[model samples]
Target: MQNLRRFILKYHFIILFILLEVISILLLANSQRFHRNRMVNTTNDVVGKVYEWSSEVGNYFRLNSANKQLAEENAMLRQQLSVVYDTTTCTYDIIKGDTLYKYIPAQVVNNSTNQVNNYIIINKGAKDGIERDMSVISTDGIVGVVTDVSRHYASIMSLLHSKSVVGVRFKNNQEIAGLKWQTNNYRYGMVEDIPTHIVLQKGDTIVTSSHSNIFPEDLMVGTVEEFYPTAVDALNKAKIRYATDFSTLRHVYVIKDLHKPELDSLKARLQ
Candidate 1:
């Protein structure tokens, strides 16, 4: 008790000075309009900063939920856009009659692009109505075709694969071409069988052909970046920068062609 009294006596003057200074500032702030306004402004600034920090923390924790919600919303939009409306009828009966394709949204569980033959694995499979030969696409463009399917997963032969050939053509004049990944480049591929007479322009967009049974007509594939003739009589081949960045691929939709089975059966009869 005696030691504590001596310590307080030594530092009491300093403590008193601090307390008095605080009191003086408080009184001045209360009496002066400028000081009171400054005090209120400081308080508001501090509170605002605290609120912002708390909001950021909350958002950080909810990121997964936000992503899942976004995926679901995109899925719904894809479904709505997949249907074709036949509006030729006089009455309102045939306005919303035909649906050409159905979409099943799935997350890319695994993906590869560096190999000669790259493939993607999606979370949806037979149980989710995913089947072999179903077209896979992202928001930007076509991804691949489903090659194999299991109960809960499906493998896609990515557009980056060497054997991957998608029937494509220019959107301007519908000049048919074949799109294939001949090199290991992930950003670009080669479009073969483009006519030499069709003056190729840089940045010309290429898209899926109308005759493609796997993908709907006019689905964007890539843009032409370069072109050169392989031989004197051969068609010109052009390098195209792929629209879909496989490295950033996350969500995808598996498209089931409604009339594909019937088309396949009819083709099989010829053989």
Candidate 2:
């Protein structure tokens, strides 16, 4: 107590001066309208900046949850869009009967687009209703097909795979062709077996065909970039600009075809 008293006595004049300065400033601010307004504005500016900083921090933490919610919502919207069609009177309506396909939203945990057979691993698995042969798609377009699944994770055979062949048809003419990756390019793929007689314009859209149960009909695959006449006079091949940008893929939806098992069972008997 004696030491504290001595220290305070030594600095008593300095402390008194500081206190007087604070008091004078406060009194001036209260007595003058201009000073009062300036103080209020300064206080508000500091508080507003603090609030904005805190809001940015909060948003940074919410991004992952926000992404998951968006994925789930996109799945629902995609399901609704799947069977939308026009009625006899030209009114649009969803297809009758139970839902033909359901979507499961998932996030890409790992991906490789530079290899010959690019693959993606998703955060969902069998426990999440994912299964082999299910179609995977992104907001841009078709992504790949699920090839393997465990209890908590799934592997996707990306469309960039050399062996990947998706049945696609031109949006304008409905002429069918096979979409295959040539293993050399990531941005494009080859459309083989298109009839040469069918005229193709640059930027023509190619989409999935009803011929396969793996993917819904008319799902976007790519756009025709160019075409060349094949050695076989009756056929032509095309270069397509793929819809999905594999290098930046993040979220994907797995499609579950309700009747796939039944179709597989029926085909099993033939084998």
Candidate 3:
């Protein structure tokens, strides 16, 4: 107790000076409008800077989610672009015709590509006019087709699966081939049955062919990464790097070709 009293006695003058300085500053700020305004502005500026910095940090953490959302939006835009009809390029004038293009935007509720027969689930169903054999695609490229459907959801056969195959062709030449993915690589596929007579180059764009009614012509699939002619046959097998990155897929658009049923029915009769 005696030591505590001695310590306070020794530093009392300095402490008193510090307290007096604080009180004098407060009095100056309260008495002078200019000083009060300056103090308030400085405090507000510091608080604002702190808030801004915190918000930036938060946004940086949420960038991945934001990018996924943007990818989904881009996919929807591409789907719309695929079906958009330009009257300037129309060769025949129509009297009273409904729009030929239709797309059903759906989110990927479930997806799997590592399996031999991979499949994807979308948040659409029979009630929404989705049916079997409908094409599914993302912003980057083709995804798959609707294989099954219920009242509120549908399943798709992803292109990444070994069992999945689609007709594809090169953009430059009309050389057509079948696009299939091996279970080994998820990012790419093999274009089989392309003849050696069709010259191919690296980075050549591949797109869906018009041979089938499942998907429309000119839908982008991927780019040619490598090509090798068969040792015995004249067919060339080209490795295609898929445009859609399967590891990060989120949203897709289901395409319903309204003329498909009529075309299929006519073909069946011919057969």
Best by lDDT: 2
The candidate scoring highest on TM-score is: 3
Tens digits of per-residue lDDT for model 3 on 92-169?
544336655588887765666676667776667778998878899987789988876666667777887656778998
lDDT of 1 at 81: 51
Candidate 1 lDDT tens digits, 126-161 = 789887788998877899988766666677889887
lDDT of 2: 0.79
Off by over 4 Å in 2: 1-97, 230-232, 269-271
State which candidate, 2 or 3, has the greater lDDT. Answer: 2
What's model 3's lDDT at 117?
A: 62
Task: For residues 198-223, write the lDDT of model 2, one tens digit per residue.
Answer: 88989999999998667899898999
Candidate 1 — which residues are off by over 4 angstroms?
Answer: 1-96, 229-233
Q: Once model 2 is optimally superposed onto the true structure by TM-score, how far is the C-alpha of residue 167 displaced, in angstroms? A: 0.6
Full-model lDDT, candidate 3: 0.77
Whole-model lDDT values for every prediction:
0.76, 0.79, 0.77
- In candidate 3, which residue ranges exceed 4 Å CA deviation? 1-98
Which of the two candidates, 2 or 3, achieves a greater TM-score against the reference? 3
Give the backbone clash total of model 2: 0
Angstrom error of the Cα, residue 204, model 3: value is 0.2
lDDT of 2 at 204: 96
